[model samples]
Target: MDKDFWLTKWASNRIGFHSTDVNPLLIEYWPALSPKGDEHVLVPLCGKSEDLVWLASKHQKVIGVELSEIAVRAFFAEHFYLPLVTHIDSSHVYYEFDELEIYQGDVFTAPLSGVDLIYDRAALVSIAPSQRYAYAQRLCSLLKPGGRILLITVDYVQDELAGPPFSVDAEQVQQLFPGMKTMLLCRQEADQHHPKIARQNLTRFADEVWLIEA
Candidate 1:
């Protein structure tokens, strides 16, 4: 998968991955991270996710990096937020509204740093496994020392389906972020009744939440 793929996905509204509601796991586990409430939170590959709104409520600043300009504008429009837009560079457009800021560009190239907490609800899983190492490296560079990540990942049989939402189990998570202190926070069995899993005919699907300290 590449930038054009995601840009096409957003332009075509083929966004089954986009969630309308705040993730329950985030609500339950974010507080355990014990955020200072003045910290800068980063949400990567954030496609107008409602989780960004929730994070903005809890933090002094919430920065999201998304590739789709369509998604970025939709976010502020949906929330009735009139953001001040600026072209940061050829690769990036910056949008700011109140406590929320979104960089509409490629995650790897976006100018990002000093992130206190990273909320990785769907970012990691969306990357092709071959590129996850690069993704992890870029994220680590953006994060401050002692920064924390509240990451949610899904695990399933890779051969069972072609995926943008790929199977990234505990071991792969460790491999992706070698030497980072990772603690598994929770695991929930994926609902077989859910249309995504049901159609794929996956026998085992589970979501794991992890707290990573850098």
Candidate 2:
């Protein structure tokens, strides 16, 4: 997908994928992963998620990489935070808000490392299938040895609908991140009552959650 597609989505206020509440799945499944306080957590393609705020309170530092500066600023502004800002480079800006460190830049190129845990709620399912493997590689590379990921993906028949939340099955995930230890933490029918499903004409959808370790 073109980078501008997402930038335009933010520009035009078409981010239907963004949720109004912290994802319930994250809340229910995260503690089982056994987070040690004071570890670094990276959230890829983080879009001003309240999850970051929640995470900051628990972890030593919460790092998020996003492409939209608007989203980054709105995140702190909406929460009534005044961040200490710094320009990382031409492509990146850093905002230090409480324990949250949000970087506005390309997720693929961010100087991200030493990530003890990764929270990937929307990143995986939000891109084209052709990019999924590379995305997984980038995600895994950010971790230290034995680092873990809390991942969520969606699966559906391609012909049934188009998507930013594209269908990615178990086989596809394994192909993308070979040799990783993985456990299925949750699998259920996606909320069919979601109003967008009717508008998109989707026939079916399934949500899958995984705990992945390198």
Best by lDDT: 1
Q: What stretches of model 2 exceed 4 Å from their correct place? A: none
| Candidate 1 overall lDDT versus native | 0.91
lDDT of 2 by residue, 84-171 (tens): 9999899989888767898898888877767899999989888777888788989888888978899999878877777787888888
Query: How many clashing pairs per prediction, in order?
Result: 0, 0
The weakest ten consecutive residues by lDDT in model 2 span: 190-199
Model 1 bad stretches (over 4 Å): none
Error of 2 at 161 (Å): 1.3
lDDT of candidates 1 onward, in order: 0.91, 0.85
Q: How far in Å is the alpha carbon of 33 misplaced in model 2?
A: 1.3
